[model samples]
Target: MGCILGRHDSFVYPTWHSDPLSWSSPLDSRRGPLPLSPSPQRGEGERHTRRRAPSPEGRGGQGVRTTRARRDGFTRKVLAWYARAGRDLPWRRTRDPYRVLVSEFMLQQTQVSRVQEYYPRFLARFPDLDALASARPRAVREAWDGLGYYARASNLHALARVVSRDSDGTLPAEPEELIKLPGIGPYTAGAVASFAYEKPVPAVDTNVARVLRRVFFGKRETRNGKREVWQLAAVLVPRNGKRAWKFNQAIMELGALICVARKPKCPGCPVRPVCRTGQSPVS
Candidate 1:
């Protein structure tokens, strides 16, 4: 387990914890801290066998030059960059599930600056799930006025109602369960789970997808490439939840600020040494 260090004016780093009670944010007593999927248990006395390592093609979803050392280096470089340049945003400060949900909903297809303007205002009006659930539909829509994609607001409202009524106002801490909520797709679910609950999961948005493809696959976007990108994302996520949170945020930040869709700023990229696109002579 890991704990978030003090809110630094510059960089924020995740520190490992021997005791979970020392965590920066209080954990849900019921669900506890969710972990990555468990490995299959092996029976005692089973004969050990050595098998040939899989070829690059056989190791699907991993990076182009995937290896323990390579992966660890990649993680280190990204975190170091984040330490130097990660943005201090409103959503990154809290572990409250309700606030995370609202932020994720508001951030969909919206710029960070715009979300920054609207997030606090929306939370001031409807502070929690119960408040959002009890609000009138028109009011919710009105709060989301300038933030295009009105359907997201409606879905978030519906999700709040369902959670309040059926789940006793407790938002689920797991991505699998979070996905069941209205308006929350895979990416949003992962975002809320990892960001709010510190679950070790990948949150792949357009920026994340772009970074993963260029760094790992070294190719332009394709309809068939999404599955591989997600696989690489999942494989690359840190096992520690708090570290994973920083990793996900760092990668997304890298994509947004450096790996722009048009003419990426590769000269300043931190992970350019290991990135396929960055290393390419043509790129």
Candidate 2:
């Protein structure tokens, strides 16, 4: 065990022949030392990373392509993809605020498949804000029993009361105004406005964030950069009447179906032409 080595001032010494005073090994023995490689410095191989592209947060919510032309081009391709390949979920078939609100809450933590099981019955029971606001808390909870996250139902009930009593029994058309309702966060408010009222605003959740990162930032970031993702989504949303709503929905749908967290389907991706990691996965 005498072949141990020592490091000092970036220099290495083998205890076998090195001066005992110059270097000492905790397990110094007469067996002789072997050569070793230096450890990698912090971010030493970062240059070899496939995609070191700058995020929108780094460039004031514009990412690499700041021009309106590139942004619009990306938006158009995504919308086209959605038009041809988007899923035909029940939620997409309506513009009713009440129905959209019910769908959004049902979808918050539950999957689309499971939400389908109860959405129809729930909506049938509480057809409007007046109906929901007037219903008992126990009834609402019962409708949401198998759905889990009972708080979403509770909040929805509370929101119904607020809208019915304070705001004419109607959901607000503005995203900001919608946010004041119970259980209506940024995502829900934006979703309600865009999907129901057709407002041109960004409504990002985890899935939307993944698509934005893969398309613009060339990576994935759910936390720590979520606000940045939302800002970027808003910037990228098209202003062509219904185009913004479609664009926001398109990006989220793309993330869920194609640009998934693992094994993204680059071949069928309409925006893959401009994707960094898609172009050079091992760059």
User: Using TM-score as the measure, which candidate wins?
Assistant: 1
Q: For model 2, how does the per-residue alpha-carbon lDDT over 95-125 read when each residue is reduced to its tens digit?
A: 9999989988888756677878898999899
Worst 10 residues of 1 by lDDT: 6-15
lDDT string, candidate 1, 123-240, tens digits: 9999999999999999999998998768778778888888898789999886656655566555776788899999887777777877777876776544446555555666678879
User: Total clashes, candidate 1?
Assistant: 0
The CA lDDT of each predicted structure is 0.68, 0.65
Which ranges in model 1 have alpha carbons more than 4 Å from their true place?
Answer: 1-65, 220-224, 281-283
* Residue 53 lDDT in candidate 1: 22
lDDT of 2: 0.65
Could you tell me every candidate's TM-score relative to the true structure? 0.77, 0.74
